[model samples]
Target chain A: MDSIRLNQLIEENYQKIFLLALKMLKNYEDAEDATQDIFLKVYENIKSFRKEAKFTTWIYRIALNHIYYMNNKRNKEISRFPEAHEMRTEMNANPSSVLHEKELFVSLENVINLLSPRQKEVFVMRYYNQLPFKKIAQILGKSLGTVKSNYFFAMQKIKNDLQNQNLLEFQE
Target chain B: MKCIDKNILLDYLNDVLSSRKKKHIASHLSECGHCRRELEKWKKILDITQEFVDQDVKLNPVPPHAHITQRFSKLPQNDESSFWVRYWVKPAIATASLIFIALMVFFFAPKTVPELTENYYVIDNVTYTETISLEDRYLDNLETLYLQEIYENEELTYDILYGDWQNYEEVLNDLDHDELEELINKMYDNEIT
Candidate 1:
């Protein structure tokens, strides 16, 4: 593809891709690096893109792979679960409706981070990105049944965790 | 479909299920209070997650360094070094050095004795009854007796001395008239020469 096409792809998807990396990696610096790295890798391998899969799916695949690899490489890098808890406590301190949505968002993020990597990915694709299970399966290079199972298990785990944390009571 | 698996219900709410399946799961959700409540909880979670997506992630989306894209651009487009270049460099260099040394030795060394034929000699003089050689100098022959000619009446036996033994003494007992005449004529010829 020409530079113009590549530029358009980046302009459209840069934010989503950056958010995905940031969500997975937690730290801004790491997320930015990961994002840039992911883009560079995408640019490098753009020729290999098959028309059968969606571009978003391919980008997410690359982003997820990069996150896992980065996490695996540096054990000292902590998960973003702390921000989730911090935001939860921070949100409760202010009793305004404006912050209520943000608090719930933080709670959801916490719950997401609590999930195992596979389940978290499946959950993110299924719920956060609103991706279909078939596309999710393709991005994850797993069978559709496996994707379903991952999503199922992830929701169960989140339910259990929420119940344990007493966050389930807030569901109306 | 007995108790809506909360997970399946989540999929259902997302409209990810087929039409027939959604109807079947919806029936199960209505009949099952616990499943219904769980599904509500998940809907809340999804709503919360969507809210998070809308909220500012509180991150500087601008990459830390302005030159990050530039850095990325400069990274080796292809990481592979040429295969032959990596492996053949040392061997090619060594081969060149070896050829250089061989050529030096071939072109710069001194000429050898074998090239000049310095070990041979030639001798000319007389025939011998036996193979004979001088004591010191190999160029001289050392036979003391030789037949110069066969006469009608008899053969003349003369002593031939070579090298330092050129002074020779004859040991003949009698001399015939022809022999005497021959000896006399030889002596006379010697005197005249």
Candidate 2:
């Protein structure tokens, strides 16, 4: 793709991709970096993109792959530098007031971040990106049933977590 | 009559069901308290998640980076000739050269026939056939092993496992007494759950 078309693609997808990265990575700085890297990858590989596939689906595939790569790399780094990771967690935990005021959000983010890789990817794509399950299946290269089940399981987990914490109330 | 499938309820939540199906679900929700409660639980979760996302976005607006576009402008142009030269022309030339060399060797190379007794001939033929069969099986086994490794190691393995909030444990472990007390104080101050 030419620079003009590339710019257009970037403009259209920048926030959506960033949000996916944010939800997947759970850190603002890392998400920003991942977003930049994903777009750069898109720019480099635009020639290999076939006209037969939907552009958004193709872009989403690239974005998800990049996020997974980043996550794996981060996991390896965390395992390598356990002390530094603990210190950072300590620093982030220092802001107790901010966290307390938004405990539900923090808890929700925690539940989301803890989801299994497949479930997290499906949930982020469906909930945060608002992509249809069929489109999510196309992007993830999984069957539609697999995508929907992953999403359902993710939702069930979130509901159970909220209920256990008594963050949500409902008549029995 | 039966409780709605969780997947269909999700579809209803997402508004992806067809209007007729959507109406069917709506009517069912009125009569089935169990399904209605299920839907309400999902709806509340969705609403809360949306609120969280909204607050996050408000706190951190992602403006597009100018440096990315600047870098894009610096990338080499996708010239068609360069593509063919890199992907097609060089490989084609190499293939043609190999074919030509093979043809030359077939036509011009000297061939020597080995003298063999009848017993030696039979033994050699049997050994050759056995070697060929063994090699074919060996190659088939190797290919299967390689493909199995790839399938197992593929990055996007969609296993059907539910999340159990392990990170929440990690977070709880990271907090000390003072931090926990501060967090509780703030929660009480804000009257938040």
Docking class of 1: incorrect
**Candidate 2 backbone collisions, by pair:** none
Listed models, DockQ each: 0.13, 0.23
Candidate 1 lDDT: 0.64
Q: List the residue pairs that clash in candidate 1.
A: none
Alpha-carbon DockQ of candidate 1: 0.13
Question: If you assessed candidate 2 against the hidden native complex, which CAPRI class would it receive?
Answer: acceptable
Candidate 1 residue lDDT tens string, A95-142: 222343545445655777678878877766665456688888988889
Share of real interface contacts recovered by each model?
0.18, 0.51
- Per residue, candidate 2 scores C-alpha lDDT tens digits across A18-64 of 88888777777778899999888887787787563488888888888
Q: Best candidate per TM-score, number? A: 2
Residue-level error in angstroms, candidate 1, position B115: 76
lDDT of 2 by residue, B1-193 (tens): 8889887998899887899999999999999999998888888888987787666656666856888767767665566467779799999999999999999999999996664442121214343532223345666775685567557864523321223446656787899999889888989999656
Model 1, stretches more than 4 Å misplaced?
A47-54, A76-105, A170-172, B29-34, B56-193
Stretches > 4 Å off in candidate 2: A1-3, A50-53, A91-100, B73-193
